[model samples]
Target: MRRICVFTGGRADYGPLLPVLRAVQKDVALELRLLVTGGHLVGQQGMTTERISLDGFRVDEQVENVLASDTPVGVAKSLALGIAGYAEALNRIDPDLLLVLGDRYEALGVAITAALRLLPIAHISGGELTYGATDDSVRHAITKLAALHFTSTEEFRSRVIQLGEDPERVFNVGAPGLDNIRTMAFLSQHDTSKLVGVTLKTPVITVTYHPATADPQGSGRGLRGLLAALDRFPDVTIIFTGTNIDQHSLSITKDIEEYVRRREASTRLVSSLGQAGYLSLLKISSAVVGNSSSGIYEAPAVGTPTVNIGSRQDGRPRAKSVIDCGEDEAEIAAAIDAALRISRDDLPGLSDTPYGDGYAADRIVHILKTVNLKPLSCKKFFDLPDSYFYMCSNQRN
Candidate 1:
């Protein structure tokens, strides 16, 4: 059996990796080894490793690498710690292949360690652009290190090829997170309200803001603008999810805490809602508001509109349901107003997303099962034809 070691850093990747992990574990020809690290181990991030176990997947290894501070230097030190911890874990597991998703620094550290160890990597969600955060560079870096690429869209698959990865080894498997819309039993509005300890209200909005590391002002300014915009709708119930463990994340969290405290009756801050609860909330929400990629990828899949704030999700393919705006209070408020105007009757069409048909995990598993791993250790950069650039130029016109 070929052992596939899947590396999950935190909630961000874990939600998408869940179906992939389950597929790997259930496949007879594959052995699943899960290595949990980063925000999964951080208490402020909700210790999501427990959620992994509760979801019935066995944690094969746990690496505590996150530091108490989220400063630039602190994040760098944490990356160093991650590299060291992953080195030991990968040496012990020594899987036939390393499977990692997204562009988190922790995932990059894992890829680096695996590359040095001569372990082939299969990367998911590669070749996507989040121009606002440093993840754009990190994701591209992982693509070069990986042997096989599974992209969420054909455009992303083309981008991976543009990055010099062999097109033959790249597969467009759609977004695995969308698979949850089909497989999971989502909670009802009443159940969701009970789970969140808030009464069901119309025009409900779920907010999940992470630090846009590219922003010099950090996430606070954008978050403040979002809070002020949210205040414009006094009747709307706002549910805020935890901030990601990135630089400036602490200040963002603290700000959200204060904002929620001030508007206790209408706003609630939930550090972690687990996958089902969160998705369920999205299903019942009037709109998902934030810079989170969830608003870009999953909200539309659940027939909810998204008010995407700031540049954090810029360059990513978005459905028509998404309304983008700058981090100014007026801009955000206008976007929220536009998103709220999207009627329930209009949402079904918006659910037709570019991501996929919810079979990404099955497709990913089939390829992993059948793909020849012998040639993966030796990668050859596939240069684009001269005419390819010409075609791109023509399209630009």
Candidate 2:
């Protein structure tokens, strides 16, 4: 059996990795080894490793590396600690392949460890852009480190090839996060209400915002603008999810907590909602408002309109149902108004996303089971023909 070690740092990557983890475990030819670390072990982040156990998956290893501080220095220290911890854990588990998703610092540390150990790495959700955060650079860096690539769209596959990875090594398998919408049993409106500790109400909006590490003003200004916009609609029930452990996250959390405290009657804050509750809430919500990738990947899949605020999700391909707006209160409020105006009946067709049907997990698993691993040992950079560059230059002229 080929042992595959999957690394999940926090709730952000866990949702997309859940389907692939299940597929790997069920395959007789594959042995699944799960390594949990970062925010998964942090109490403030909901101690989500327990949730993994609740889902019937055994946690093979736990590495604690997230520091209590969210500063750039603290995050850098945590990344160093992650590399050390992952090196030790990986040496003990020693799987044939290392599977990682997305562009977090923890994921980058593990990928670096795997690269130094000469272990082949398989990356998912690569070749995507989040220009407003450092994750954009991290994602491209991981793409270079990985041996096999599973992208969510044909456009992403092309981007991976442009980065010098061989075309054959990259596969456009759609997005695994959407798989939950198709397969998992979502919570009922009542159950979702119970999970979030709020009564069901119309004009409900789910908010998830993270710090844009690349932004000069940080996440606070954008978040304040968002809260002000939400204030414009006092009757709308707002459900806020916890932010990821990024730089300036503490400030963002504090801001949200204070806002929720003032509007306790109409607002709720949840650390983690698992996959079912989150998707369920999306299905019933009037609109998903925030800079989270869920608004780009999963919301439209469930026929929910998204009010995407600011440049955090810049350069990502979005559905027509996604309304982009600036960070000003007026801009955000206007965008929310536009999103709320979208008719439910007109959404399913209008939200036709380029991310494929929700079978990405199956495609990723099939490639892992059947692909030969020997060629990965001698990885090479694919060079585009000179004519390709010449054609680009001619087009520019």
Candidate 3:
């Protein structure tokens, strides 16, 4: 059996990867090894590694490298520690391939160590753009290191090929998180309200705003502006999910906490809801109000409307369900009021997912099962002709 190492760093990152991970685990010809670290171990982030245990995954290693400091320097130091820890663990396990998802800093550390060891890496969610945060650069860097790419959309697959990766090795696997949505039985509306510690009478706004924290000063002033907007709607109940660990991540979480605490029963602040429960909440939510990627990608799969704030998701594709708003409090309040006015009967049914269907796990497993097991080659750079470069630079498509 070929050993496949799947690394998950946090709750948000794992939600999209879990279906693929389970596929590898049940495959007869594959040995699945899970490495849980980062926010999974952090107490404040719900310690989501427990979810892995509950799901019956065989964890091979856990590295605790997350720090309380939410600054650029702190992020660098945390990455360094992750690299060291992952290097030691990889040396012992010596898997045939290291699988990772997304472009977070923690995943970047795993990519670096795997590249240095000449281990073949299969990266999902590559060839995407998110210029608001440092994640954009980190995603591209991981793409360069990865040998096989499983993109969430055809557009993204083309972007990977444009980045110099061979087209034959790249597969458009759709969004794996959607696979879980198709398979899992979400809690009923009443049960979901119970789990969230709220009565079902008032409208529920599922909040998941995160700071574009890689900015120079990492201020969540936009998020603060969002809270200020929410204060206008006195009857709505805001179920606020916590922020991630980036520069100013703490500030974002703190601001959310203070806003919710001051508002008391009007807002309920919970750190993490595990993936399944959160998706269940998405099903019945009046509107998913935030700049988090969940609003752009996952919510639409379940027919949920999103109120995306500011430039965080500036250029990404959107469904008709999303309502984009500026950073001003009045504009956001107006947008939410408009969303609240949207009749459930008028809401469109879940359409064919542009990001993907629920088949990413099968496609990813097929590639991993059939790929040649030779050590990945990273020395060659894609050679572009001067003519092509000039045309591309001049905006001639």
Off by over 4 Å in 2: 349-351
Which residue window of length 10 is worst by lDDT in model 3?
213-222
Instruction: Report how far residue 187 has shifted in candidate 3, in Å.
Output: 0.4
Candidate No. with top TM-score: 2
Regions more than 4 Å wrong, model 3: 216-219, 375-379, 384-397
TM-score winner, 1 or 3: 1
Q: What is the TM-score of candidate 2?
A: 0.98
Q: Compared with the true structure, what per-residue lDDT tens digits does model 3 show for residues 40-120?
A: 999878888888888888779998898778878998999999999999888888899999999899999999999998989
Candidate 1, residues 160-253, lDDT tens digits: the string is 9999999999999999998888899989889899888788698799999999999847456788899899889999998999998889899889
lDDT of 3 at 53: 89
How does model 1 score by TM-score? 0.97
Local distance difference test scores for all models: 0.91, 0.92, 0.83
Clashing pairs in 1: none
Tens digit of lDDT per residue, candidate 2, span 1-397? Answer: 9999999999999999999999999999999999999999997789999899998899998999988999999999999999999999999999999999999999999999999989999999999989899999999999999999999999899899999999999999999998888898878899999999999699899999999888948456789899999999998999999999999999899999999999999899999989888889999899999999999989999999999988899989998889988888999999999999999898882238778898999999999989898787568999988998999899999
Worst 10 residues of 2 by lDDT: 346-355
lDDT of 2 at 121: 95
Per-candidate TM-scores read: 0.97, 0.98, 0.94
